[model samples]
Target: MSHSLSRLPTLATAAVAAAIAAAEPAAASRAVQSRTVKINGVELFYREAGPSNAPTVLLLHGFPSSSHMFRNLIPQLSERYHVIAPDYPGFGYTVAPADFSYTFASIADLIDAFTQTIGVRQYTLFVQDYGGPVGFRLAVKHPERLQGLVIQNAVANVEGWSPDAVKQLAPFWKERNTETEKPIRALLTADTTRFQYEHGTTRPQNLSPDAWTMDQAGLDRPGNDAIQLDYFFDYQNNVAAYPAWGEFLKQKQPPTLIVWGRNDPFFTLKGVEYFRNLLPNATVHDYDAGHFALETYGDEIAAETLRFLDTLPDK
Candidate 1:
């Protein structure tokens, strides 16, 4: 399922309007370059930084956002860890066939294909938002491909959501109704993006305008709104896959770090507890931040992540 951008509300606010105007001139000045990779017939657009042979870190974004979400965090990490962030099919610069079935499992296959195509045999995985399901699917299929795991504001359990979001989706869980449910599915916009950052973070106003603008433009792209809505609907089944995901962790035991936004709106702090219990060797950090901790506390979180990596005796 795909949606046209016409359904998304246009940002006419003075602040947002001004940011877009300012970004236009400098957009060409930005140094990051993007490339297209074909996998299973889907064309994926991805941004790359750092040396190819450097320690690899694959970053995955969630719904209503893209690799664009990592605009700020990527450069910082690239200095140390070779970074690759791709816009999922139907999101960012990637384009999904109008008839494609946008399931989490399918996305995992694409991730695996992209990595192999790029000659990455092993690398760390960083997951956020929908990245939980998508990245986890990759983990389940190719646990050996993962070097380590870092999660920010991703749900490892169904128990991590706020009561409001759970309740809102409860009805659609029982029945399949896109027309009656589309509006609610389309609810995550700049307003909700702001809400997600503020409510999910310990500090909200620290967000950057460039980061916000990239998110807005990617979601505003034509035909993206529907894909987002479809993914929201697909998330209902994500819970069913959790038990197997947990089982995979128990069997594989990938060294894990939990960088959680203490105030995440969708996934509560309980997710930290869940990962801690599930992975005996996992280390956890709760930041006074929201869903996008990197946006609010990137430097601190990145430092913490590097510190954690350093503690690995073999690294």
Candidate 2:
């Protein structure tokens, strides 16, 4: 599941490309400039593109990934809208205090402060993986502020989970047990890169080695395993709250789009069905790609997202 560099951009190079591409075209461009906003005591790192006045689209990544996940898609969408992607605390360039609790609720709280600091009262949410729990917190709490919800390979329904995920993360579901934590940390190794890439995509040939390495580095970092372990523990709580989350979706029913990778080993295509059932008005697109469908299907996703935004009520 490795793609050559000549065909794809590395994380750092992709960031620069996004920025440069954004600056060249006044009409359609994306930049990779970064800004830090202090939320409580944590400083969140964010990258943005397009005109500030353009409609805002906030992109959220999953565990072990940063805003860099949207490196390709942002530039494409920046043509007609503003794209903002932020690194969740403890991942990417953002820093988290060693003692900080990395629960989803805490992360959600930080996102709330982050949006306010950026002066975006209303925005279209582009959430993936861990972004599901984090973004749902914002959607559930501030339903009025969301113009649309664009979900990419995330679980809103418990049925969407794969058996492998349940197996790998099962030990930590109830609470963090030291025995279960060891293998959880082991998955961060270089070997898991192939597993990660293959799980997320149908076309393993398209997976970029650098992307896998970037994510691996973050997971392999000192103390980072604790954050992931905490997230694993919090995810059980998220699973328990799934019913309430579905009810929230039914109640709020914001304009939504569900773009999923059928091959995603973690959040299975069942996740898309969950969103469809809850968001009866949702537009669902299941691609042959894997969990990181946006990476392989950025063009289609960007186009679909723009169309989804078009269907939203005027902000």
Residue-wise C-alpha lDDT for candidate 1, range 38-123, written one tens digit per residue: 88788889998765666788889986678888787777676656788988887778887886787777788788899999888877
Please give, for residues 1-315, the per-residue lDDT of candidate 2 as tens digits. Answer: 365755456777889989888766775345657788777888789888887788889998986678878888888778778889888878888887776778998888888888888888898999998999989889888988898999998897767898877887877675567787877877667777556666646566666777777888887788877787777777887888788888999888888898887888788777777787778888998888877787677778888988887777777
TM-score of each: 0.84, 0.87
Candidate 2 matches the true fold with a TM-score of: 0.87
- Minimal lDDT window, size 10, model 1: 1-10
RMSD of 1: 14.4
Q: Candidate 1 regions off by >4 Å?
A: 1-31, 178-183, 200-202, 311-315
**Top TM-score hit:** 2
Measured with C-alpha atoms, the lDDT of residue 314 in candidate 1 is: 36
